[model samples]
Each structure stands twice: as structure tokens, then as C-alpha cells.
Target: MTRVFSERSSTRATRRPELEAAVKLAGEIRSSDVAVTLVVHEHKWLGRGTELAMLTEELKTSDVGLEFLTGELKGSHGPSGIVFTVLAAMSGMEREYLRDQEVSLRDIATGAKKGQHSSPATVMRMLREHDEQAATAASA
Candidate 1:
């Protein structure tokens, strides 16, 4: 929960009603310094990365601790710094996948030139293995 919801409040950046309620609640009860856990079924509920980063920082400023589980990212996380790190890495991750795709195309093209498939299977296998490893790490 990240903000107090009001029907008249037009500035709620996060679309999740529960988050807004939680934020409101946390602010009210923050004298005891309790942490809030926010569960999100969709990453979009957090809005853009910048929005999320700012929300976390706001929580910290108000002495409200925040922990979150997001289905899109599929993990439980706390700490505002981690949000910035994760957002920064997202573009690099996308770039890695895009480069892999290009490599696959080049690999097959090179094989075709020689009348063979130059084993693009290796690239695909590596990608699958990477996926498996990531799943394992996430589950752990």
C-alpha cells in the first residue's frame, strides 16, 4: 500500500487500490515503525520504473518500510536501492536478448553460405539453459 485513496484524489500514480490503501494505513500507523508488504499481480500496477523508484524513496522518507512481491518480476524484494539497480539492469537484459537473436540469425546465415546449419542449436540451447538457471535462482 502506498497512498491514501480518495475518490477525489486524481494524483494516484499507482493504479492498485490495495497499494494506495496500504500507503494510507502505513502513514497512519508508522509511529510503531512497521513494514508493509505489497503484493502485485502485474508490474504495471506499480506504474513506470521511475514511479516505483520514487514510491520506494517516499516510503523511506516517511519511515515506512516496504517489501513487495511482483508476479511480473516474480520475486519478493525490499530496500529502495534494489529498485534502482533492477531498473538499471532491465535495459541491459533486453539488449542481451536482442543481441542473442541477431547472433542466431548470423549463425544460420553463415551455415547457409557453407551449405550447412553451422549449429544454431548451440545458441538456442544456451538460451534455454540460461532460462532454466534463472528459474532455479528465482525459485530459490
Candidate 2:
């Protein structure tokens, strides 16, 4: 991946090997003086809540920063921000859409358990169910 940086800031892709190394080093240092912000292409990679949570915790403890959208910092950071934002947003949205696929897969598994045909087209119902369950669990 490209190492994009300016006088006061720097960024790396979510899946970059350099970032992995940096995180490892940061873990060893455990110094509050070291600050790093990891900016995610919010539209591309933030869909995995568990992954995000774990990474966030690791980075937070090591003084690393996580940014969800680089496009928002365009014009202010680098020449690529404006163009990257559109691509990043699209990527993030695409991942978000896969959660729908997860709902379908869950339905399919449920149907198999019940000896019934599964229909994955029920987007509205699945979203509502997921939202309500998430809210209930959150409150609990």
C-alpha cells in the first residue's frame, strides 16, 4: 500500500502490512506519548463490528487513531482525498450490503432447521428484526 503523509499526518490502508507492524511495535512500547490515527474507508471496512472493536481496542491502548472516512479529510490532507472519498464510500456501502446477505444466510439456515423453503427477499423484515434484537441486546 501507499504511504501517504504530510507534515502533521499520515495514513495507511486497513489491510497494509506496515500497519500490522506498527501496531505490533506500538503494543511493545505502550507509551501514551505515541499517537496514531487509523482512518478506515468507512464505507469499505467498518461493517465487521467484531473486527472493528478488537482493532479499536488494540489501537486505543497503544495510542493509535482510527479514522473511518479519509474522504472527509480531503483538500485538507492530500491530493487523493477527494477522489478516494467516493471510492471509499462506495467500498464501505458494498460491505454494509453484505450484512443483508448474512441475514439471508441466517434465514436459509433457519429454514433448513424447520424443513421449509427460505426466501431471502424479505429485506425489510430482516432489518427490522435485526434492529430490534440489537436494540434489545444493547439495552440489556
Superposed model 2: Cα runs more than 4 Å off: 1-19, 25-32, 43-47, 70-140
Per-residue CA lDDT of candidate 2, range 40-112, in tens?
4432233222233344446555654445554332222221344333333333332355445453544332222
lDDT of each: 0.46, 0.40
Model 1 worst lDDT run, 10 consecutive residues: 111-120
After superposition, candidate 1 runs with Cα above 4 Å error:
1-18, 62-72, 87-140
Cα lDDT of model 1 by residue, 70-136, tens digit:
4435565554556535543442343344445564434332222232221222333555789999999
Top TM-score prediction, candidate number: 1
> Which pairs clash in the backbone of model 1?
1-19, 1-22, 1-23, 2-19, 2-23
**TM-score (C-alpha, index-matched) for candidate 2:** 0.32
lDDT (C-alpha) at residue 36 in model 1: 59
